[model samples]
Target: MTDANTTAFTNPSTFILLGIPGLEVAHVWISIPFCTMYVIAILGNFAILFIVKREPSLHGPMYYFLCMLAITDLVLSTSTLPKILAIFWFNSREIDFSACLTQMFFIHCFSEIESGIFAAMAFDRYVAICHPLRHSTILTNSLVMKIGLVILLRGSILILPCPLLARQWPYCRTNIIPHTQCENMYVVRLACADTRISSYYGLFVLYCRIGLDVSFIILSYIQILRAIFSLPTKDARLKTFGTCGSHICVILAFYIPTLFASLTSRFGHNLPRYFQVFISNVYLLVPPMLNPVIYGVRTKEIRNRLLRLFTHKGTKAFSSGVGPQTDLPGVAGW
Candidate 1:
């Protein structure tokens, strides 16, 4: 778009993302680690998905949210990884303007979905802890499906405009982007027209998203803590803490890196490019890799069920002379 509000990039076809700012290092160095992490992240999240889908004993509102969370992680990992890996491995970071818009759209959509899923998980944990008597009543199949639909609606409506607005912008200026992926603000800053409106809208979008999701998470925990402290038995208190602890850890791990990147960039703009890239990458890779482990490995019940599911599957396959993963255990309560 032109500076005076003219739609400059109206017919733009392609744009280029400058690979990771500046670091004379070879692309392979970046590609290897980045691709490795993406692979690990995808596999880890998918394993959790597999476990949840196969283990019937783990079927419940909690695991249902976990399934959604895993799906979010998968989408989040996939959205940016391919481009990132391509830029790093092949030294080709240029993407079509439309492709950039598509990447931006999916990134925002999935990240927003991630937050929405976390908020849903928080509510699930809160209900299990706070309203044990009515947890099932409140978290029925219909209610969970309704929440899922709300998440889909919110994500699609909030993020669809990003690509639409971006694509409509005129791009007579340089098509150079400083990052591998067309991150919302990064790509937005490249518009020939003033991006004040886009920035405001971006903040509004985030405000609505982060504001709503984080508020629900905090409020859920607030009531959860009150209920836990009000309980009499030490065993009761520990059990309550144990149940919520995994979720708390996962939330902190997910949110803190993001907060660090945002605050650091805001206050430390002078930080080197690789440093910024590294810090930003942490938020992407860490959560996907750690989430399933935090929720499954550290939790006893899910771990036991996972082990049974896998071991039983292996035994059945070996007995049948098929293969290790020939048959999966059915989902809980299925």
Candidate 2:
């Protein structure tokens, strides 16, 4: 009888994604804001890439890292948003088994990579402020490339097991995922077989990667703050703090929603299902949408380059002696 029951297990070839449980009627209205944010995220991240690539002066470790970050945000958001929008708009909820696993992998993997990039950016700020003399020597372009490769490899390796483990589960239960996307835990819970192993493995990977990155980021900022305060003049101190302000804002924007969503998923089962769904969606949408905006508004170099890009006609008039010429060498054609 036991062997017969075990042999009776069947895995569905496709899973249906519920856009948001208990809010099916509002999917269209809800997609408006989500669609808006997704559009902004795409355009903003691409703009960052374009400006950084066009300007040679922005070719330092910081902007290089920013470019990598922009690319990561692009991929991270692109992975889930389009399918989510389709689910919302067309009520297209069916996802193939392999496709679901692929989506799961991309969402989690790039998120970890993005977190690592934040740590890298924090370290860049620390070196630039705390050890100005060594900043140039330490974070050369080649070294930054190596760091990026290591981050990519580490995140990919760590998250690869999640979907692989998930795929091994005997999902004899129903194939309906009660969320917009194939979130690891949500999908794993659909297995009729015991899922503690998969659940614990996912948790273990999350804590180890995110915890290590967070610790490194915190320590970097602590040393950076100390260095900022040690500056003799108030102006120097403020100026130094200003340099880190954008990165700090971006870090908070990224981590706060992520941590909240993570906690809500694990511990806030008593919370409203809709609220949990909302926060999970927010977690994926907000950072990518806000990151480029924060940097464009706060970072002088990037901001100025953006202004130059959009206002090149006015810049041309000014360069013709109608006003002061603020054009730099590499930015002439832009």
TM-scores, all models, native as reference: 0.86, 0.91
At residue 327, candidate 2 shows an lDDT of 19
lDDT of 2 by residue, 1-334 (tens): 2342344456778888888999999999999999999999999999999988987767778888889999999998999999999999999999999999999999999999999999988888888777777777888899999999999998899899999988988888578888999999888988878889888988887786568999999999899889778888898787667677888888889888988888898899899888888898887889999999988888767777788799774565434434223212111111
Q: Candidate 1, after superposition: displacement of residue 243 in Å? A: 0.8
Q: In candidate 1, which residue ranges exceed 4 Å CA deviation?
A: 1-11, 24-26, 264-268, 309-334
| Worst 10 contiguous positions by lDDT, candidate 1 | 325-334
Residue ranges of candidate 2 with Cα displaced over 4 Å: 1-9, 313-334
Q: What lDDT score goes with residue 183 in model 2? A: 91
lDDT of 1 by residue, 1-334 (tens): 1232333444456677666777637667777777777787787778778876765645677777888888888888888888777777676766887778888888788778888888988888777777776777889878888898899789989999888887766666666777767877777766778767777777777777667788999998899889889989888687666667778888888888876765554466778876776677778777887888777776665665567666765556433434222011211110
Top-lDDT candidate index:
2
